[model samples]
Target: MVKFGVLVLLSAIAIGQGETTIESQCQVCQEENNVYCESESTFLRMRGAMKLGPLSCEADEVCSNSGNLCKKKTEITNEVLNVCGANCQSCSADRKYTCVSRNQAALCLNGQASSTIIIDCGEDEVCVDDDDGKAFLCVPSCVADYQKLSVPCSSAAFTTPTPAPPTTPSGDNQKSICQAAAVNKKTLYFFTYADSSCRTYVYCERSSSTSTDFTTTLSGSCSSPNPYFNTVSGKCQASVPDNCESEAPST
Candidate 1:
């Protein structure tokens, strides 16, 4: 939150028979306040006893911790950091967005909910509470039941193995998948593994509306913490739904 203040100074002098008073005006910024980003390019923080700035970040940079600190867009994690331009919302104790609808979730920032930002689940996906019920995550269409997706697809649930390729030699088979999407009038499609591993996904895009053929743009696994492709926001997210396989615990 942004805070504003007015500063006043006064002095009095006494003469033999009269007295005079002097006053001055200034602005106040507390030194102890935590730094926060006010926008993508600007931030406000304390410098000494005065408010520093809603200062501008350099080109290719965005605000982060202290107002003086800025970083490249690729250096920061979108889901974890309280960076500017995240469109944070107003939220209290429960920071997670409850499903506004079966397919939609609210976007939050710094424990506050954004007044306007909401995420819609992708095709064949639905908004559901995560395993701990501490947050909401978009899960597959087959998982509408209240029963948690606790069971792993295989018995070796605790091991972290390299993600296996799709069951059908799917990487060599982009034409069929892309054609299917094109037939449905969709120029773009994102597909996860058949095993619900949540580690890898594929992205395909048609060249044009007239084109029956498509190209694969990305086929890879997500990074740590956000090892799952969230169908709701169409981005990598931190949570691993119960239906998805879990990584081996760090020794």
Candidate 2:
């Protein structure tokens, strides 16, 4: 039986005429933290392809843009090497790759053919829709269910006086940087959006109408120390932070 990667590569080459002719072998590509499939011929056609860097795939996986993963004809190249551990399945399926065996960390997957990139949300974080909704992203458990997160700190996290709970205070008391409810008192410390500098952690609480009080803060422009918000954990983190939380919604 013909391997999936081999088949995709052959197909691309067979059609190359005016094109630079993709080699008759699978090729790898990279972007951000992702690995994908791209023909050498196609890469050369790109305007700024050189900025993308070298192409590669796992030793066991073949780079096939059509297959979406390192698998061919329904067979996976590297099963045990799945991202997010054995609890998950393929990480190169499509826009959102990954199979969950447990409620543990969800992986943000993206790639073409067999080469893919998997970003870990860790056990505490859950994968959700990115801003673009084109792909999945890891977000804090708190952010996922903000209506149920209880922030009971008696500090200045609340400035805008508004109505109390919708009906009754939710049964959420988990500790996280993303607060769902308004703190009773007013303080000066709050979870800010993750920024490139990771320097600010203070955001003025946005107040809602008197009937329902919800404190919403904008992204970026937070205080220092844990300025950048880790998107996955919905928590404030230090500079050079990972996990996708940030003032830049692009993350």
Candidate 3:
């Protein structure tokens, strides 16, 4: 009987050791602090405070157990801008705009009309246009166009195929004559109906000229090479030259 009891005790001890080995082999958590278990029955049910090791598990296993166990990392590029997504960041003029990424910066051209320059930024990067005056933040949609208008005397001529005015005068009466001619004959139309000449003539005829000042004259042709209109100034202003921005890429 003594020998039999001794054998039974040894058997029980061996069983306990086996259970401990199985528990150690099972992973209790994942790398991202997620809990995992191979078997529901093996999990401990006790509440209260339990000191657990760092949650560590294989990637595939962790993903299989919990949908939120892991996340894909984003790749950073060299062309990204430094001040991407921030407010009022300056842009590079050479390429028309600058972009910043987590690891690098890049310059891109603005392809759209009135588009502002921009930089590349990582998922959390911010950029802004210092030139905007309002300090607007840069976004993926941001683009820049820094070309200036070249307004030469010849460029002022109407581009439309329509016949030119009877003559291009050479004196002070040139502007006035053009206005009077445009009004009376209605034959002097701007290449683009919205030509600066149209505005100048209309303004001179309505506001500057009077019954007695009919002979008065203004200098320069009214046509402008630039198409932009400054509503605030109520006039047409020249745009910044591409070279000007090149010297100062930012702001």
Candidate 4:
């Protein structure tokens, strides 16, 4: 047979606080001002019953302290599971499309869900986080190349009936000069027009060991009117021509 005990506090304060009574089979000590002496023991037993061990014990008199502790524990457990989950792998999508993890899927293009394809790239591969928290496909290299088209007119050409400049290089054309000098040899570079002409200047540096690997390859033209390099994404961007920009230039 098990023993039972009913402990009752007859104080008016206890009655008003609804803490006047406690029923249990174990030894329990009571305190004034609505405090319970054996509260830790009761809480430990409750946690044990739930298979959580004594980790649920509170460190302060208020329940908020215990709640915070439990919440922190839950967060740690979740982080471990997410990073080390059995299905841990890279994800991919189509051209002009991107994908990220479910937790970060909102950051994807137009806040859409990531595609189901899992890329085989390693963790070191470059990637972007969509607004939804999903990691999207990104390029790994920093260097890129693009072809430009242009038709130049000479200053000496027809004032009233001047003929158009030759379609080919004339040994004095700026484009031919740059092409002969190989000024655009560098892989990662940015180009922009000057004086509203077809002359495009490039910005770049020699590759080094610490170069940054760009992740996303944007197809649209940059909206800004200047050509500048983005250090964070390692890409060169132009302000004109909508949607033809490459991924960030490599550092």
Candidate 5:
């Protein structure tokens, strides 16, 4: 199989053709970060091509647009800005790239622990560290010596609340879940969708300071590697559950 990196190099070559070519004067960053694309050409080329570098900046380093590559935080002459925006609070660089598994990874946005986004490698890709082992990257599974790559953290390093199903639930149904919890006097509750499809689940919680009041706090479709939502465990699992009413949702 063609490697993802090789495919990127091919796309870069193709972009140079016709009007899509990037010129020397283009005001673009010399390097790309794991989160955002720095150059318009690079961004355009990678929009749907494949996953690109999820490179991270060191604790003392900041992603600089200049050609010298990453620069020390102290060297910045202006206010420091997080590319991921305000919601992501600053955290240590050690939490930057978390490996959920060889095929899955999560990026600590703006170095923030609470704000993380999962990075699912392509079907043929696997998560691995860069040559320097300073950043987490996704490469073709066929690449050799992948086990030698560094893994910044284990699955326990960061965990996101199970995502709700892609389909929005009816208001009455959402209210019902919370109402059941409230009636049971349960502070928190997790339950599978009525259809018992492995794709989605609901997480409900009682409103603070209101014992009788409850609300649906979060819900979303289970992601890759753990696509099936096991009703008994109230979490996504790798295997099919006996109660599953449907196969995993199409990607």
Candidate 6:
């Protein structure tokens, strides 16, 4: 199962020396033994590190052997080179997120679990863990940012040490998941907003390609999006329950 964090969004830092952790704060780390040292190559990792968006690194910033990736420097025993896909960042300083060649929900269960690799997705996409915690996959996000999502749906986005939706299409302009179809193929996307209302939206395509517009499947305000879509009930639920055992996996 995925070890989801409880903190909101990417602010998953462990309190130390009476202050929260900040990756760019290298000077503070030098003064406090308890604090992790920020990576020396901050300039090199700027773009990638920002993607950490609201997520925190496993340790303070210790540079990866390649100097391109960063992770906590304390994980000496678990350090190993891992290959990440183009969708996600090449590596993370923390182990919470990982990259897999295949879009399997499975986390880094094998030898690579310790590496700081993040699953790949589009610039607007995010890595979403399943309700069962057995699988993690990349998908477009609903909340403008991770820090705002609510329960269950927040599990994947809020992967801090202690931190922590869907719908279909229709003929009505509002009922459709998107205004157009996917450029690659017909793919259905799910999202939950971080707004206090916690509205739910979906972007389903009739083909395998990408699309510019997405449709709102459900607009449950003040409610989080269910981790999995219930094909049986055709509604959003905490869990999909079936996991599509009787049917083939949907694209």
Using TM-score as the measure, the top candidate is: 5
148: Cα error in model 5, Å: 35
Q: Cα lDDT of model 5 overall?
A: 0.39
TM-score of each model, paired residue for residue: 0.25, 0.16, 0.18, 0.16, 0.30, 0.19
What overall lDDT, based on C-alpha atoms, would model 6 receive against the true structure?
0.29
**lDDT (CA) per prediction:** 0.39, 0.28, 0.23, 0.22, 0.39, 0.29
Using lDDT as the measure, which candidate wins? 1
Residue range 1-251, candidate 2, lDDT tens digits: 11111011111111222322111111223332233223211111111433221112222333333323333233422321222211122233333433222111123334321222223344544533222223333445564445232111111111111111122111121112235322443433233333334432223233432312324332222224544444333344566456334243332
Give me the runs in candidate 4 sitting further than 4 Å from their true place. 1-104, 107-177, 180-199, 203-222, 225-251
Q: lDDT tens digits, residues 138-210, model 6? A: 5445532333221112112212111111232223632332442233334454332222222222223233235
lDDT of 5 at 25: 14
Worst 10 residues of 2 by lDDT: 1-10
Task: Give me the runs in candidate 2 sitting further than 4 Å from their true place.
Answer: 1-8, 12-171, 174-235, 239-251
Model 4 C-alpha lDDT per residue in residues 134-195, reported as the tens digit of each score: 33333221210011110011111111111111232222333333333234344442222212
Looking at model 6, residue 194 earns an lDDT score of 20
Cα-based lDDT at residue 210, candidate 5: 49
Q: Give the TM-score of candidate 2.
A: 0.16
* Model 2 residue 118 CA deviation in Å: 11
- Per candidate, the number of residue pairs that clash is 8, 28, 26, 29, 7, 40
